[model samples]
Target chain A: MAELARLQADFAAAILGPDADVGGLGGRVEGDGIPAPLRLNVYRNNFRQGLGTALAEIFPVVQAFVGPAFLKAALRHFVVAYPPSEPMLYGYGAGFADFLDHFPPAAQVPYVADVARVEWAMHELQNAVEEGVLTTSALPEAGRVRLSGNVRLVVSRYPVASLWMAGTGQLPPEAVNPDAGGQTAAIVLSDMEIRLLPLEGGIKTLAETLWRDEEPDAAQLVHLPALAGRGMLTDGETQA
Target chain B: MPILKRTEASAGTEIGVGLKSQHYQDVVATSPALSFFEVHAENYMMKGGAHRRWLDAVSDRYALSLHGVGMSLGSVEGLDTAHVRRFRSLVDAYDPWLISEHLAWSRTGGTYLNDLLPLPLTTETFEILVANVSTLQDAIGRQVLVENPSAYLSFVDSHIPEVDFLAGLAERTGCGLLLDVNNVFVSASNMGWDARAYLDAVPASAVGEIHLAGHALKEVNGLPLRIDDHGSAVSEEVWDLFRHLIRRVGPRPTLVEWDTDIPALPILLAEAEKAAVILAGETGRRKAAHG
Candidate 1:
């Protein structure tokens, strides 16, 4: 009975990646007329396809940017490097953007990683808690006015969000500039819809500051109305 | 002693279809007279959103069953306390008629694969399941059902048959069983076991719910492997077994689960209707006998 856990660990290692000796566990299925390696492959296929499909769902525009073939090649390496931590797949690909950044083959498509970040932020904000817009009455008393739980500030050296919007058909294809300059986009839920609002210099700093729970300075506070006007602030609480 | 009160079990009759997000509007607008709608509990494991709002509206109109895929009940370590709490929150919010998790492990050492991986039917795994089931029921303050999994291959150390293993787990933990007929057929076919005998081994009263779903056939090393992909319509063989089991166990809350390549709501409901015909008769007789 005690040997079962060891076997599971060995088996999990075998199916999860190329590492771990399947020789011991694979031998067990040999007597069943199904070779142990073949049996192990079934789970290998299931995990790859199952987690791969999930990764694809979260980073669709990234898949679009790199093309399906390249994306799948990248996923094969990503799943093994960082297997899902939990079963709720909604937020599983949070690290995928980082994975793509270091992924060798993806270097050709330099903006692929940033594109993934935008998609991940959008995926998160889409399911994030919706809140009522903060009112003027609530602003003065609050020491730090936090953005909505769904607000995500994405700063990239490329116009990744625009490319994603164009790729997903949210914006006209002509609006997308693959070589466009760096930009900051705020992924937030507005009007019950996920929106990517392009942020300027000051607004970008304010968004980042508010997201980090720090008090925005006068320079950043001056941009609050612009952000507030866009319904980005959801909670206004005075900090001690 | 059970820590929580048991929500009344679904009379183990009637047929329900899984509520997919794609079909949420239809479910709300049409309000199909389904026996109930089963949803993946993890999908609704959120603070607030359209998902919960829509589900709240739907629950008011119909019965709900919370089928969880992420608890990893069969993990060696134990049930995740946080995950269980989240599940309990949903249960409290909806007061679902049935709640279930698989008898397979999806996590080991910390990595969660998100797929129901097979567990060896050993005394060791049995004890783990019993403890996890007990902990989950106590945490949720209600009895939860454990569903049998379809295995692609058998473990060499597996000393216990799947049926007796589940029955013993139930007897020890006081948890109910969610007998998935499709799983029985898939596992039986994959491992060369008699599907009918497997059904006979399960105590009828332990079954609180039934699941019928489609499976994909794959060939591994020249041998047939039935994968419980739940992609297409229920096959003719699974329907036959479902019919045989329903007669033996009487009516149970039957759910038509189409997780992949899910067709339209009407198509899924059509499949549920087929099971409804079989259930309608047996459920009527039971109601009359009780009255």
Candidate 2:
């Protein structure tokens, strides 16, 4: 058992570690005409290529904004630094947005990380279980409220919602301006479709307040009906 | 837990294909005449959304097979209980006719490499496999089939042959076998073994399902290496081996897997159709032999 554990640890290191260094693991693999290192490259390629492709699928918009070549290069680094902890690939890239934020090469595109954040949020919401929405008539007047399970709030300094729309072809690329200040958008799954609803005025304050689990002030209370109508607000009831 | 029973009447003629998200709408609209649809269990491990909805719609119309790619049954660290619980939930919800996972391990330490890594056929690994397979079967409350993996390299210290290892696993744990003909061909070509001899040695009665998929051929170190990419049509050699196995083992529930570079719905169905024809021929041969 100890020998098997050592063999696996060595194999994993050879694959996930630096290039061309198989250590003593190379001799453990059979060499039939093909060199051991060369054979080991097959698993290496599979690990990098397979995980890289899965990450690309999760952040297609980021790939589009950064170009496939750039995204592929960035992913080559991201995957090594942050491999998935679980087998479910859909929930794989939780740390990607954070990685891009600190990535030196990605620093050129300041808004790229925010875009990744949006994509990650949507990816998460898309897979989240649908919860019951409180009807506008059923809303409790002056009490605590919460965002639905399927809704995600992404408030970014960049106009990330428009950038995401352009990447997904919802808006023309020319219509989005990166320098157009900030945007607060609620990514909500309504009627089985994930919609990006931009929030402003009292509605934004109301959402931010409820999202923090703090009671909305009187000024933000006026927008309660609008939020409930969109199926974004839910009664503050803990899930059973 | 009532397993979806595969009756003797429907044994040989059923042909299924890998369920791809690209073909979800078309499948819902056309409802193709497939015996079942095999899904990668990890892909649908979500709590809810379009994937679950689509799978529900399709599973309503066809028998489903949950083919897991990430169980890491051969891992020395033992089974991930959380993963097994999630898999059990999926089984409880879908009640698939056939449940299968690979004979390879993909997770080591804590990180999941996302590719099926080969395990050395040593006594230690064999014991690990037996323990993990037993745990998985006990958790899911059903017989789970273990599929052969495509190998690019072999461990030098391993003395047990791959076929004997699988047969031993079945004997010890009462698990069934998913004989992947492409893997047999790929591993044979890469490891310098005879594909026919490998097939001849498999315990016929233990094979509950068969997988036929395409592989990509690449030259590594000036030597031919067959990668099980499943990106194209089923190779002629794999189809021939499929015929050879069924000629001896009789027909089992067969699936056509095309995971990468997925073509149109018709292309995948055509592959499944080809397998159906071959299976039907085998069934006819068996009938004649009995008569």
Best by TM-score: 2
- Candidate 2 error regions (>4 Å): A236-240, B1-10
Overall local distance difference test of candidate 1: 0.82
Give lDDT tens digits, candidate 2, residues A1-240.
887888888888888887767875967899799888888888988888888987898889998888999999899888888888899999888898999989999988889898888888888888877777887999885667778886888788989889989988999999999889898889898777888888888888888888787877788888888999988976544232
What TM-score does prediction 1 earn?
0.92
The CA lDDT of each predicted structure is 0.82, 0.88
Candidate 2 has what TM-score?
0.96
Off by over 4 Å in 1: A19-24, A136-144, A170-175, A208-220, A237-240, B3-9, B281-291
TM-score of chain A of 2: 0.93
